[model samples]
Target: MNDSEAVMKLILHGGNARSLAMEAIAHAKRGEIAAARTALSEAAEELHHAHQLQTSLIQAEASGEKTEITMLLIHAQDHLMNAMTVKDLAVEFVDLYERMRASKGVEA
Candidate 1:
């Protein structure tokens, strides 16, 4: 794929990961532990795909292939980083919800 296309793919996957992480938080709020965990897993998968694309670009550069640094590429990187952070926070939120439920003698 072309550089722009690759960058766009990264952005898309990163955004998907972030969205799924948010969905996880919503599920957690409703005390749906299973659903929340599932969403978090899906987000991780999406992040994995984004990371693969990023690794390929880095590898290309390491092999002496010139890569154009564009605003879109930078934006894609931002999305990936933000998504990762959000996913981490979502996991913590899910765990917190589970703990809260447990403390109340409620099963999820």
Candidate 2:
């Protein structure tokens, strides 16, 4: 696949992961720990997929193939990186919530 297509796929995967991670946080806030964990797991999976695609693209470029950069491709890369960042932070957030729940003697 071309650079644009590869980047777009990363965008979608990353966006989905970000959205799901945020939703997981929201669910945890509402005292839905199980649902939150499930959402978080899904988020992680999506992020892994995005990361794989991005790694592939980087490897292709490293192998001496020329990559054209479009504004949309840049935007996609931005989205994917931002999503990965959010996902990392979300892991801490989820863990904090779990601790809080446990402190309150609530089963997760």
Candidate 3:
């Protein structure tokens, strides 16, 4: 893909991952462990796709190809980083909710 298209793909996947992660947290808050896990799994898949797209750029650079750093690329990177942070927090939130449910003897 062209640089612009690749960058857009990254942004799309990153946003999707972030959205899924947020959905997971919401599910967890409602004690829907299965649904939460499903959402988290989807988020992980989207994140993986984004990472793979990023790795292609890294590989091109390693091969002595110069890639211009554009504002859109920078924005894509920001989205990826933010998605990662959200996913991390979502995992912790899911775990916390699970523990809270267990403590209160609420069936999942």
Candidate 4:
């Protein structure tokens, strides 16, 4: 795929991951721990795909290949970064929710 196409894919994956993380957070807030965990897992898978794309681009640049830095690429990177942060926060939220439920004598 071309650079633009790859960047778009990265952005798509990142956006999906971010959305999934948000969904996970919502589920946790509602005390649906299992659904939250599932959403988090899906988000991780999306992030993994995005990371692979980013790594391939980095490797290409490292191997004497010139990469054009475009606004779209920067946006894609931003999306990925934000998604990762959200996913991390979602994990913490899920854990907290589980603990809260346990403390309330509820089965998680």
Candidate 5:
């Protein structure tokens, strides 16, 4: 597949993962740790898949063949970067929510 296609797929996977992670954090805030953890795991799997795709492309490009740069590629790159950043932050949010419940002496 072309670089743009590969990047787009990665962006979609990353976006899906990020969305799931945010929802997981929301669930955690409501004291559903089990559900939150499941969501987090699903998100992580998606991230891993996306990362793997990106890694392959990077390695391929390093072998002397450059992927053509296009607007679509730029867009996907932006989406991927943002998605990854948000997903990482969501883990902290989930943890924070769980701690908030604990600090309030509440049980999930």
Candidate 6:
């Protein structure tokens, strides 16, 4: 795929991952641990895809095949970074929610 197409895919994957992470947090808040875990897994998958794309670009640049810097590419990177941060926090939130449920004598 072209650079623009790859960048768009990165943005799409990042957005999807972020949404899934948020969904996981919501599920955890509702005490639906299984569903929360499922959502997190899906988010991870999306992140994996995005990361692969990013790595390919990095490798190309490292091999002296420079990719032109563009606003869209920067935006895509921002989305990926934000989604990664959210996913990391979502994992913590899910763990906290499980602990809270356990402390309350509710099955986690």
Clash totals for all candidate models: 0, 0, 0, 0, 0, 0
User: What residue pairs are clashing in model 2?
Assistant: none
Per-candidate TM vs. native?
0.98, 0.91, 0.98, 0.98, 0.91, 0.98
TM-score between model 5 and native: 0.91
lDDT of 4 by residue, 1-108 (tens): 777888999999999999999999999999999999999999999999999999999998999888899999999999999999999999999999999999999997
| Cα lDDT, model 6, residue 5 | 86
Screening candidate 5 with a backbone cut-off below 3 angstroms (N, C-alpha, C), the clashing residue pairs are: none
Q: Candidate 1 at 52: error in angstroms?
A: 0.3
Candidate 6 lDDT tens digits, 1-108: 788888999999999999999999999999999999999999999999999999989988899988999999999999999999999999999999999999999996
lDDT tens per residue, model 3, 1-108: 877788999999999999999999999999999999999999999999999999998898899988899999999999999999999999999999999999999977
Q: Any idea how many clashes model 6 has?
A: 0
Instruction: Select the stronger candidate by lDDT from 1 and 2.
Output: 1
List model 5 lDDT by residue over 12-49, tens digit each.
99889989888888888788988998899999898888
> Model 1: which ten-residue window has the lowest total lDDT?
1-10
- Give all candidates' CA lDDT scores: 0.97, 0.87, 0.96, 0.95, 0.85, 0.97
Tell me which of candidates 2 and 6 scores higher on TM-score. 6
Which segments of model 2 are wrong by more than 4 Å?
Answer: none
Cα lDDT, model 5, residue 33: 87
Stretches > 4 Å off in candidate 3: none
Looking at model 5, how many pairs of residues clash?
0
Ranking of predictions according to lDDT = 6, 1, 3, 4, 2, 5
Q: For candidate 2, lDDT tens digit of each residue in 8-99?
A: 89889989999998998888888788898899899999989988888988898899987788788788889988988887787788889889
lDDT of 5: 0.85
Residue pair clashes in candidate 1 = none
lDDT of 3 at 1: 88
